[model samples]
Target: MGYSEEKLIEEKVFKDPVHRYVHVRDRVIWDLIGTKEFQRLRRIKQLGTTYLTFHGAEHSRFNHSLGVYEITRRIVDNAFASRPEWNEGERLLSLCAALLHDLGHGPFSHSFEKVFDLDHEDFTREIILGDTEVNQVLSRVAQDFPKKVAEVIEKTYENKLVISLISSQIDADRMDYLQRDAYFTGVSYGHFDMERILRVMRPREDQVVIKQSGMHAVEDYIMSRYQMYWQVYFHPVTRSAEVILTKILHRAKHLHEQNYTFKHKPHHFYSIFEDRMTLEDYLKLDEAVFLYYFQIWEEEEDEILSDLCRRFNNRNLFKYVEFDPAKEYKKLAKLSMLFEQAGLDPEYYLVVDSSSDLPYDFYRPGEEEERLPIHLLKKNGEIRELSRESDIVDAISGKRRTDHKLYFPSDFLEKEKARPEIEQIAQILELNLDNGTI
Candidate 1:
């Protein structure tokens, strides 16, 4: 149904833990959600292997999709409903962009992207504009409707207000994911005054800005982002899982390149290795399919592949200790030789995981690709960048924090004969032997 005239006879509601309730009033949004492509997100974990570390984080991308749609709905109705700066005609575009933003995300999104050199953003655009149910649904609104939605998602839509609602620093997408992720992970750090923030959010000439009164809420939001980055997003154990998964794919590709016969054909991964996957083939993949492959790969003839698959499946994650990259590289290189002496291939057995993030930053004068700085609307009608007005934001602005860890299978080192060398290496690295060391 085109925007000209279409309405659902009854409203639909999804009980969401983060948003409480996700409401659907339009038949088009409802139909789009029911499509096979959209339903596939139900089988994909939003945080991927992070669930292995945070047991409560089992929520799916489908849950997040609804949360995002709900957030967008609220922003439209509560924040911009009667505002002259916000065009009522752009409501559907905003909703569509929010609902379908992560549509092209494959299983274990970032890890998959690293292993396969695939860009989820490109695929997202393709899914919205390609020959599929999503494209067909958008086309029903108008011949150019799909392109319009794509432009909004790409942040190139002529309507700057509409683009900002979905893509801004404090927009609905980030607001939904942070709160939703925190809810699923059972962590309190992600909680912020979303209601207060939304209430104070007003449309400016070409973008959205928070009122001066909501500056604290914005600071809290930034702090929440900082904590989530350190505690959940860049957790070393999660990165260990990622490292192992990446190695597994690398090993599989290596084996295939060497013409080693696989006991079970990796049909799903064939196109991935060849870099020729069609949208249809990519859509067929989800966490379930990948997990199934891992289960089968555990019995593979290759020891490295089999071991990695087993570790990933059983959650026997690599043990890690803090490492100083600049000072420890030479020592780490020597440790690799020691591992080789002990018959463990350092390439597959030892991993260095480094995670870095910028919690907040101010706009640099000539920075090529800087974020649109968060602006606060003062009581006197003057706009000031957040860090300029808030001490907390100022303290952390443009500051980047990073962590480095060295991961290895400590259980392998426990073998009686290898214990001495392992202990010596651990001592040399000044690794903590306490329970929290891992």
Candidate 2:
């Protein structure tokens, strides 16, 4: 038998703060949401370490996942369900792909991925195609349905139109996360006309495009993304917290490699340290699982691991100063030496982090893995890339901006002001100790 097209006798609704009501009609989606693997998302924070900086960012990935699914549902069911340019057959595929896109994200996904050299997308594919309950449900739809959903997430699907709906510049994932993150962070940067943008979205032969009339809304979205990237996503304090997180994981991994006994071993992280994270082991980790270890590790005999865990758990994050790696290598080296002299290990105490993004870009042919540019569909049945037509988009299109910051435990140096090296290091780093200014 083919995949079931069964619809629920009545829809289920999740009262979301961002989307208001996330409606679910298809039984497959409902069952997928109820699966153990999908339920695991509720335990992972949407913004990871951002909550330490912005107390309001305590929302979970499950919340953002539902919001993404709801937005994609609106686009497919409302805007294109009756349109000939869109394939009605791919509706479930798009919805499922959107819902499960972030399923593989571990606790503190970015730092975890970096320290362990892992990809959440790879885990996402594994979960959907493996022996998990999610795979079982998808296989019932037809043995290949899960693969279709996975491909959409992977951006390797033959249907470019479907891939763009979830992965493009102005796709449902960004549309949901921007508004949802803004609402949770209590910031104004991520707010834009998602509703109007959705209303203007049209599926083309190759991809989804917005009507030219909605160009202003699209411009606002691009600008909103730019603002949020700097203000919220790239906040230095948040990065400071992330630095500590990355260091904590690295320290734990190093200690494990040396066979140094951890007073409280990270049983959940064993597979990760060995660079062989099975799907079962991956599913066992979440923020709570990490936090439990952090709390316990705070009492460990190792000063570095204990201090970092206490900092992360107690919100005693490192302080950061503006840094340019190309020009500030000497400054970083000098600070490292000072930290070592001050009895702080420079390997764990001193760190540099960078955040960068291109606000928008039009497609460049033959560019491997470049973004698919935003398009504006004209009334005359013509198509134009956004930067070619919009002044606002053109202004920043193809421009990549990067910001770097150096993170260090200020308290470590401040505790002993009698040491002249601390002052010299502070002077070189150009920090305002009075106000913790960079």
Candidate 3:
């Protein structure tokens, strides 16, 4: 007997601030969410340490997973309903792909990746295809259904419509996160007319395109992305938290390598430290487990590990100021020496965080890693690349922006005795203590 496409006896809705209501009708998605793995998302923060900067961003991946599913449902309904271009057979596949996209993301995903040399995307694929509850549910649909969903995530699905629904230049994932993050962070910068964008979206051969009249709407999205990148995504204070978290992981791993015995074993981190994490172990981890370890590690005999853990837990994020990377290396070295003299381990205390991103891009012929350029369908049925038709997108397209900030603990230096030396270090870093300039 084949797996039946059954709807829940009673429809379920998750009250989401961004999407308002995330509706679940299908039994499979409901079952998957109820599984232990999906519930773990509640413990994993959606924004990592951004919660330290934007307190309301304490929402979890469970919140975001539902948002993604809601966005995917809306997009599929709006764009693919009664349309010949979209295969109705792929609707469930698209929703499943969206819901499970971030399932493999670890606690503090990017920082964990940097310290452990791991890729969340690879882990995401593994989770969907491995012996997970997700894999079992998907396999029940068809023996190869799990592979199809995984392929959609990997952008190699034979069904381009399925692929586009989850991962186009302006797809459901970006659409949801922009509005959801903006709402949670109370930042209006990420807002755009989502209904307008969805209304104009049209699926076509192997991709999705917008109607020509929606050009301005697309421009709004591009600009919103630009502002969000600077104002939220790359905020220095958020990066400061990241710096502290990274150093914490580094110190712990270093101690582990030196055969040091932790007063409390960081068992959840064992797979990460050894670089052989199975999907099962990975699924067991989330931010709460990490936070639990952090709370316990605050009392460890290791000064560096304990301090870094305390700093992360208490939101004592490092202070940051803009730096001229080309000319600042020498001065930075002297500051490191000063930190060492103060009995602070410069290796764990001083950090330079540099981040760069291109919020929007235009397609270039023969480019190796070109973005799937957004297209607008004309009345005459011709398709035009977004930047070619919209000046706003053209202005920012392919323009890469970079930001660098040097981070340190200003509070530690604010004490009366440390004030003079702290001022000296601040001056060397070209920081404006009075104005909070960075």
Candidate 4:
């Protein structure tokens, strides 16, 4: 629908939780969303295990994909389309890139990628460049339209303006997810004055820059990002579910490796177990299929598998203790031995989950895959980095903060409460047994 007269007769709309209404006008955008590959996003939850913690967080990637497109649409169409430097030819490419950005995310993407060493970006490129309906629909625009879309998503497009619009420290994708996720999770921290930010956004030679007047709004957005990472993204209960999910996959892989006969063979996981997951193999595995397997594994002969499956299905999550890995290595080692002695495989049972956040972090002179910094353009046309212009963001500029948690089954420990080793483990961590917590 680029530079053409064959546009949709009427615009379509989707009622969105964050943006209110997501408007769609391009025929190409409509067709790409209808592709079977894109529709698969409907089955994959946006926050994976977070739904276990926030019941309202049942929204899927499809919900987020549409939100991203809507944000980008507003930014491109209203914010920068009429600018002298804005290239009209790149409009469709930007829309397509935003729409298909997360098309390759697998079921429980973070856990799947961590366990299987799969890069969703690689698959995103493959899906767009390979033999698929997404590619076919994108190709209808032009022979090289798919490649252009891929380039934008990959952040390798010659047009820095396009890349910055989608992948910057503050961009449509992040903007959409922050509010969308907060809305679904029933949190109030992610709200920011996005309308003002858009009004003040200007395209620079190298990136998107905000007017100095909107600096306060940009700072608010940064603080909101920091809060969400701590409050929502790094919730202990969600990570507990992730730990159990990871162990389930690990136990299944181990069983397959040892030639342990499963009552219900996990044919769906064969390719993943071998580390040779094809696109078809990846597509076959969704949240539903995973739940199906977890249900069946609950009855498997192996105690580890059966127990973990039941734990995940019943929300019997592992209890965690705030741990300092640097100072508690020996304590952790002793706990592992105690877990093994208690008949809980330390490898699968004792999980150390770490989450790190770099608030207001941006691209350095020489850093790998560095994110471009947010800039505020002054009234006199001079620009300054966001940290220099905002006191709040400056407080923790580019500093990485980390939290480590030790997750294990408290029920298992309580069952062996009388054991000397279990008592020692509790004493080592100074467990608050009176309150039934660590």
Model 3 C-alpha lDDT per residue in residues 15-54, reported as the tens digit of each score: 8788778999888889889877778888888788888888
Candidate 2 wrong stretches, greater than 4 Å: 1-3, 356-369, 432-438
TM-score of each: 0.93, 0.95, 0.92, 0.95
Q: Which of 1 and 2 is the better model by lDDT?
A: 2
**lDDT tens digits, residues 1-438, model 4?**
353224678999988878889998889888889998999999999999999999999999999999999988998899997898788777888889999999999888887787777889988998999889999998888898889888999989999898888888889988988888899999989899999889889987778899999988888888888888889888999999999998898889989999999999899999989888788888777899999999999999999999999999999999998989899877877888877887778899888888751122332322353556788899998988888777788875666677899888888777777888788777876775546664
Put down candidate 1 lDDT per residue, 1-438, tens digits, no spaces.
555248788898988888888999887798789888899999989888888889999999899888888988998989889998888888888898889888998998877887777888788898899988988888888899899988988888898888887887778877887888888888888889999999999888788989999999999987877677778877777888888888888899888889899999999988888778899899999989989989999999999999999999998988887888887788887899878877778998888877742122222221353667778999999998888888887776667566788888876765433366766766776654443343
Worst 10 residues of 2 by lDDT: 357-366
Q: Rate the local accuracy (lDDT) of all candidates.
A: 0.82, 0.86, 0.81, 0.85
| TM-score of candidate 2 versus the correct structure, residues matched by position | 0.95
Clashing pairs in 4: none
